[model samples]
Target: MANFTELINKHIIVIGGGAAGFFAAINAAEMHPGIKVTILEKSNKLLAKVRISGGGRCNVTNHCFEINELVKNYPRGSKELKQVFSRFNVSDTIAWFKKRGVDLKTEPDNRMFPDADSSETIIDCFMYQVKKNNIAIKLNEEVLNIIRNPKPETQNPKLEVQTTRESYSADAVICSSGGHNNAKNYNFIQKTGHTISELIPSLFTINLPGNNIKELMGLSVQNATVRVEKTKHQYTGPVLITHWGLSGPAVLKLSAFAAKDFFDRDYNANILINWTGDLNSELVSSELTSWMKEKSLIVNTPLYEIPKRLWAFLVDKADIPDNKPWNELSKKHLNKLAQVLTNDSYNMKGKTTFKEEFVTSGGVNLKEIDFKTMQSKIMPNLYFCGEVLDVDGITGGFNFQNAWSTAFVAASSV
Candidate 1:
């Protein structure tokens, strides 16, 4: 049923069985019913990350209209992705998925998920499409090398992929190989002459060592500012003190944007938190002064309205005796206590992975790929997608958004 050209049968081989690979294979088959589509997955399973994404609910995409606005969410490959998003943006993805029977719902944070709130809903959608279009999915098939015949002036290119089991030739090759850090699935693709950027852990939580804040585990403060030591990149939003360390949306976003720097510095950093963000020192000084004389202070009693346990901890961090009355407090002690409460510092000994959804930021350089088609600008009949490119986003629906956008462009042009 495929075009044999002047040689044999037409086949399209898609490497990697993750989101981008699956989408590209399914869409390509649905488009050119004449061609045979095959998905080669190195591992026995597919969509392993997607299954665990968003704690298994799977954030499908973000609801951003402007291409520029959407691209900003990604720390790496922002410039190149600006072009990729222009081709197939969030609106197009919503319409494409909805028309295929997967209705999505958007939350206040712009995270879009299927109405069912289950990843099975998304997997089933892709599986059904693949089944309907006769897409062939091969698992446990690792591609060891790719061999393409050097074409003459105007002939269509033919590529052969050699696996441990067998070798298959195709009229086109879509390299949707994932990132290197994915120990199981993506190592094979890196052997094919593509430069893999320094692979480092990204989008992880920071663990504070030797800090007594572990006693305040599970306490969340809304609207706080957290700053890393010596850096102007202060994070703002909600804060959660965990048994391990700090977390919540604010810390998570900061971790993503500074992923590379943390890796380069060996996961060692210090954090300074303003329990109250953007509040002036004058207001804090006044507030602490007002609370000073209101009550008779006990040894561990806090004169502040902050969580009693946290206030006691801050008092310890301040190294000030708590039983002392406001009028008896020394001028030097007030400044020391104010700095401790207003700008407390914690040392980060290591990084904690997101556990379920871990992705690396470094991948094949984006400049080599044609953003218009996700095809190789350096080599024709070759394409790239998924995490193998230098594109990764903060947790939420952004990563999958890249998978959808890149694969759509590949399917359209290839």
Candidate 2:
């Protein structure tokens, strides 16, 4: 048996060419210039997630400087990530990309994007790093499974990566193949003796049966709150009422926090909306009263502030005649209207995935690995990074940050 220092000449194989896969491969090769590093990607393309992230603008990271705030964004593993995040975070991500000639800009919401305003910059940055390091990327080579033995030669616990065409071996293997929701990812990780938590679709839009929310299409409230009561989960962010149903940062964040619960409940649940962001009942009441007093004789659908059309929809839902003057509003009628505007609730039947940046909530449990080195606890000469081991973040630029941070750590350790 050879010691760790003696195995520096061994070849390392990284599976999955998404954010983590590429980061790991580049970092590994950069650390050990002589060690051969290769990426075996199942798909024909590399960094497919980065290509579509943030609507093609590629949110690189959030602007939050505090480690606690950054950790809070993750619904799962936030506590465990606190330590890891302290080492590498948004600032580090910015610096890493910046050093590579990829400068990023922040939006009003604190989401950082490349100066190019296109995902091309991200793909270019990664491709440049991979090429410059002379790291090998084998596309169309889907990793079918891993062969883990209690005993072995070469690097004990050898990994036999099988694709459709051929099988390959490596001294060290990092599974950055994404999540279990994708069948290939599930099969790949399951072969390694890791158990996956109940997998389900997350970060999705809520779709009620037959488009029950279709009536409220194209309505967006910049400040709104969403709640899925089953899990007592509440999310506050920009809300957009699309043709399908409620969607936006708030809805998406809510979906993520309630992902496992929703799945456990058969994806059947109720959604509570504070559309006006009226957290204070007295304030909402006084405001409505002021509006009524100012436009006592006004009928014609509530006007400015609230979209007249949506106002009429709310009034109609409250069973108040649309043409009824504000002066004629009875106490019961006002309360009913307030309920619709401030606390309107809906039945969420199921979830619809966001095609741009979808992520899984569970993976090689963090407890089973070392965040400092991204190395597997059970297997020596093995490492994990990216989406393969469960860590996920919100829609902005968090996922990319995870890829970059974990990759940085793994690279330094290697």
Clashes of each: 0, 0
Tens-digit lDDT string for candidate 2 (1-414): 345466556778888888888878887777776677889988898888788778888888889889988888888778867777887888888887889898989898888999999999988888998889888889888877777553755466666677777877777787787775755557766666666665656688887777545777887777788888756888887888777677899999988888888878787888888877746555666666766654443346563356666666767777888667787787788777777777887887877787645677877777778887888776666677777667778777777777777876776665
Q: lDDT per prediction?
A: 0.79, 0.77
Show where candidate 1 strays beyond 4 Å.
1-9, 152-155, 182-191, 280-283, 286-306, 324-329
Where is the poorest 10-residue window by lDDT in model 1?
Answer: 1-10
The TM-score, computed over Cα atoms with residue i paired to residue i, of candidate 1 is: 0.89
Q: Which residue pairs of candidate 1 clash?
A: none
* Candidate 2 structure lDDT: 0.77
Compared to the true structure, candidate 2 yields what TM-score? 0.89
> What lDDT does model 1 reach?
0.79
Cα error, residue 84 of model 1, in Å, equals 1.4
